[model samples]
Target: MARDYASRCSLSPVRKTWLAAAAAILLAFQGIGAQKVRVEEELEAYPTESVDLRCQFIDGLGKTKLTQVSWIWEPIDGQRDNIAVYHPIYGQSFPNLSFRDRVVFLQNSLENPSIRISKLRMADAGRYTCEYATYPSGNEQGTTTLTMLAKPKNSAKVVTVQAGSKSVVVAQCEAADGKPAATIKWLGSVGGNHSTTTANGPDGTVTVRSEYRLVPTPADNGRDVVCMVEQRTQEQPWVNTVKLSVEYPPSVVIEGYDNNWYVGRSDAALLCLASANPEPTTVTWTAASGSLPDTVMVDGNKLTVRKVDDAVNTTFICEAKNKHGASKHQITTIVIEALEDPSSAGVVAGAIIGSLLALLLVVALIAVLLTRCRRQQRRGYPSSGDSIATGSGGSNGGDYGNKARLLFSGTSNNGSKNGTGANNNGPIYTYREGCDATGTLTEKANDFHHHHLHHASVGNPPSAHDILLSGDIDEPERRKFDLDDSMEEEEERYDRFGGIPGGGNMLPPAYHVRRGHGGDEEVDVYLDDDMESQRDGSVISRTAIYV
Candidate 1:
């Protein structure tokens, strides 16, 4: 038994060594089969920023010695290329010229196998692959996708968008070259319908064009129209703005005057105001009827008044012109009234003056008629001789003939001779008293005593009784004497009584006579030729005679 036990112990050592070697081989095979490499499926970065693409081993052989590590990039439209390589003992290498200075190993270690790119660009977006070669493990690989996001490039232009029935365009906005199919919208001062058109680019980007149609009114002359672009990755939208300019004709209006106007008393002015897309270039003022005076001044849009007259009544036009079109406003001016014309006033004054002159001429004619009537009242009768006599000179005579001659003297009651002659002593008979067969006498005095005949042709003085008895002593000679007396009296009467009513001098009686036979007895008498008296006494005549 001792010999058998010793041999068994020595063989136990060899069996234990073989069993440990088998267990070691089995663990190594299991580790090689379970090796795994992992990488991120997607990554995101922006331009000019840093990004890390992850490629690392999640499960692999324990403490395996890695020989090689390499990175590859496959672009969306191009072939794959090696970006960088790593050898455990040698160092790192970058094989691709496109990513030479931009790619680097993370922490300068190959265990992680992650690449960090500095200053990323849009072109750098692609699929990245990492490969690893290790001792006891043949190969391991991982893939990651890198996506680059950039701000969209926005552009805008004003285009004529046809909308409604009118052939006019207000505004248009378009956005292009946006990633992830950017949404386009419009924001502006005016509200209207919009039309959108989208197109895909050769790259995986979308270009959006949006057209906004608007009907601009006068209130929307200058306004801002904006086109906004929105992407999935951006927080704030990209925008393109343009100022909209609308073109239209001018709307003209006139100011600075009311409707009430008067000639020669009203002052007025007119101003033109226009609204248009482009400012008005010229403003003109004109009249419809007559031409405006040279004194009227025009400055810019204002028409200033210099003088107002009857010619101011007309239609006024204010015209404004711009690039689009022209417009005009008309105002009719009228004259109400003024003071009376000077010529009419003068005519009225002349008529009043003529009326006053006619009244004065009528008054002067009346005054002349009244003076002539007063002169006729002063004379006793309608005289046919120059002088007048009134007296009581005859005494009553009984049974006298039908005709009797009365003697009178030529002298005035004021004791002054009337003519240029010497006084006569003899009594001159100037009148005859005639009685019919019934003894009724009528006094008839046809001639007055003439002062020129007082000194001539008085040869004898006859007594009153003898003059009454002698009827026809010498008929032809008495007729001759009466004719001469009438001629002399008529010539003297015209010389003294030119403008009086009766053809006789306007003076008092020239003689006084007594009606009784005695010289002391006297009677009152009147010198009217038509008066008659009857008495039963001798007739006597007395005359105050001058020698």
Candidate 2:
């Protein structure tokens, strides 16, 4: 019915043209929406693996029709070639001989035709176009880029070199046979520079190489260096560490010469120390002034003087030689007269010093003892030429009233004086006042001495035996005397107990003393044959008194 209406309705030429152009524009928009093709623009696969190059045709409104589909290989350096084809009548076909056995069409339909290629090689990496022939849309195509990935084998090695002034290769790193060229770099604190180079293989793989350069020295030996390689196939950079080896000539040093080589010494030796990469081949000893002395012996790097003498005094040269070079060291020897044994000299000096120290200590002890004795005597006795007399009481000869003239022999006095004359032997302390306690007697004597000293100031100081005594003394001085007296009493007790307090000695000395008792005084006298007489006609005795 629409066709009959269109034929009956006639139009002018201009109107017909306008209607035709509108119809054509409406059909083009419909074809654009009805037919669409899709393909992966970029794909990646490893070598020797299979990959699907997908191609799909979409028909909207069920109006667009597909006839045939084909895959074309567009190499980067060559013209296009048909690799795979599919048609509704002819089935699947592959024309390229290289991919004839490895490629196949995935779908038989003309709408969605995809090809799978197996056992891919590096040469197969290029652009591929999926072309489709349709009923109304004519030819529709999409392109895909197939990329092949190949991992490179990386390795690094160190080069052994002799020490030199010029720069040389010390280490090398390589990334071999990769699909894309790999980048190489050197890493380390070896203070060296690196250079990179590339190589092309016939199989479309690239090889990258790098070398580390440096002026190597002996100090650089066993130094660590690293090489790194980066490639598309690896997620992380490949790393390798290596150690460099360097050789150098010998360095020499001399040892074992203590500069104490004296005449008549035995078994003295000098040693030569040499260090080198290659061991030293020879060691020789030579004299600087003349031939080696007869007493000297040479063995390897050691020179020994069996019996040292005046002839052994000379300069010695030691040369250590190797294939690389030679190093020399020298030492001069000086001989002297035979020296005494140091141990003997040390012993003699120590003995002399010890004797002198002991003598000094004894002299100091004697001086201290003499000073203490003089101080004690001054407190206990009166000096020479001082006379002391009893105070007058009732003018009669009572026990404490008589003007008695007393003569006392003290440690500081040569003799005693009385109204009769001088007496060589007399009582040292004569107290008319009787006291039962020794302490009370000492107190009374001290008081009497002080009182008499005050009264006798007009003349010389009164002797304790000549006047009534008064007591007035510093508290500190009195305490000091009390302390000295207590210490002396303790020492006497210790001596009586055989040098160990409260213990008795099994064997005692034969020395003896007889103590005489007066009214209030202690008189001890020693009568022994070994007594020695003094200038005052009194004898000093070594007496031991036992309590």
- The lDDT leader among the candidates is 2
Clashes of each: 7, 6
Model 2: per-residue lDDT, tens digit, 406-467? 32322323222211111123332222333431211121223334334334322222332133
Worst 10 residues of 2 by lDDT: 393-402
Off by over 4 Å in 1: 1-35, 63-65, 135-137, 155-169, 174-177, 188-191, 197-207, 215-220, 223-226, 238-243, 265-267, 338-547
lDDT agreement with native, every candidate: 0.60, 0.69
lDDT of 1 by residue, 220-336 (tens): 556778888788777898788866666677889988777655555436777888886678988888888657756467888887666556676777788889877899998877666
RMSD of each: 27.4, 16.3
Error of 2 at 110 (Å): 4.5
Q: Estimate the TM-score of every prediction.
A: 0.51, 0.58
